[model samples]
Target: MSPFLINLALNFLFGSKGKEVIDLAQRLILAAENAGGSGEEKFRAVMTALSQYAQEHGLLANFPQPLREAIFRLVIEALVFLLSKQGLINTHKRAYYEQPTFPWA
Candidate 1:
């Protein structure tokens, strides 16, 4: 599930469609599984890894500042929703996802 979410995020975040995202997704899945502390901490670790990957790989280099930030936020929201669904987060946080308007609720 983490792999799927990472793949989705990679596609959305970078518009990349290839092996690189697969490799990155594997790493993310491992990181998410092995991440220590509570669920929130694990989530933060994943987010940190994602942000670092974006910066190091220049995923958002072509975008304007505001647009880049917005995209990043959406990516994070999607990630949270995905991870939560996988039981990596507390599901009680959200009732549903039918609207696709709010990431958590």
Candidate 2:
């Protein structure tokens, strides 16, 4: 749901790093969860991961540009793919797509 942060992280994942960004993000998210944090906490963890990676890659200079949104959106696609691998989101204990079934329909 918080594409903003994920997309930002995605921007840091270009070139050779692109192939491993999802795995890195998943690891950060899982680690955050294992520490008893919520999904929002996981999101923040991945954002921090991306920021740190970008810093290592010297990609931080490009982040302040206004023209980067399109690139960010592109990264969002990969982030979505990574998040999907987590299977069902556990919040509220009900399936996100679950709807009331009409037995007599």
Candidate 3:
């Protein structure tokens, strides 16, 4: 994702009504970390946690399915970008996201 898109997603996530989304992302990251396998396994763990979270939390329930999915994707991508920048997690996609511009700054 580009910095612009990442910034947009971050704006939404860090906004007033962002707690739920942020919590979901944090939980997913934790799930990935605890997956205990290759990068692919960690990715699967995040997706599995996402499913469970959706069932439990009804995340973005009021939104249409497509919009909700798009939001989820954006949230995950932006978060992974940020965390990887901080040397938190390595999904092997960091090289692609390294840019001179820092969206979270």
Most accurate candidate by lDDT: 3
TM-score for all models, in order of appearance? 0.49, 0.42, 0.56
Model 1 over residues 77-96: C-alpha lDDT tens digits? 77557656667655566555
User: Against the hidden true structure, what lDDT does model 1 obtain?
Assistant: 0.67
Please give, for residues 1-105, the per-residue lDDT of candidate 3 as tens digits: 665775577677677545566677779978988999897898778877886788696766788877866766676777777778867665576776676456788
Per-candidate local distance difference test? 0.67, 0.54, 0.74
User: What digit string (tens of lDDT, one per residue) describes model 2 on residues 27-76?
Assistant: 65565566566656655565555556556667746667444444443454
Scanning candidate 2 in windows of ten residues, the lowest lDDT window is 92-101
Q: Measured by TM-score, how close is model 3 to the native structure? A: 0.56
Candidate 2 Cα deviation (angstroms), residue 15 = 8.2
Task: Please give the TM-score that candidate 1 achieves against the real structure.
Answer: 0.49
Give the lDDT of residue 35 in candidate 3.
97
Q: Between candidates 1 and 3, name the one with more favorable lDDT.
A: 3
In the order shown, the candidates' Cα RMSDs to the true structure are 5.9, 10.5, 7.6
Worst 10 residues of 1 by lDDT: 90-99
**Residue 17, candidate 2: alpha-carbon lDDT:** 61
Candidate 3: residue pairs that collide: none
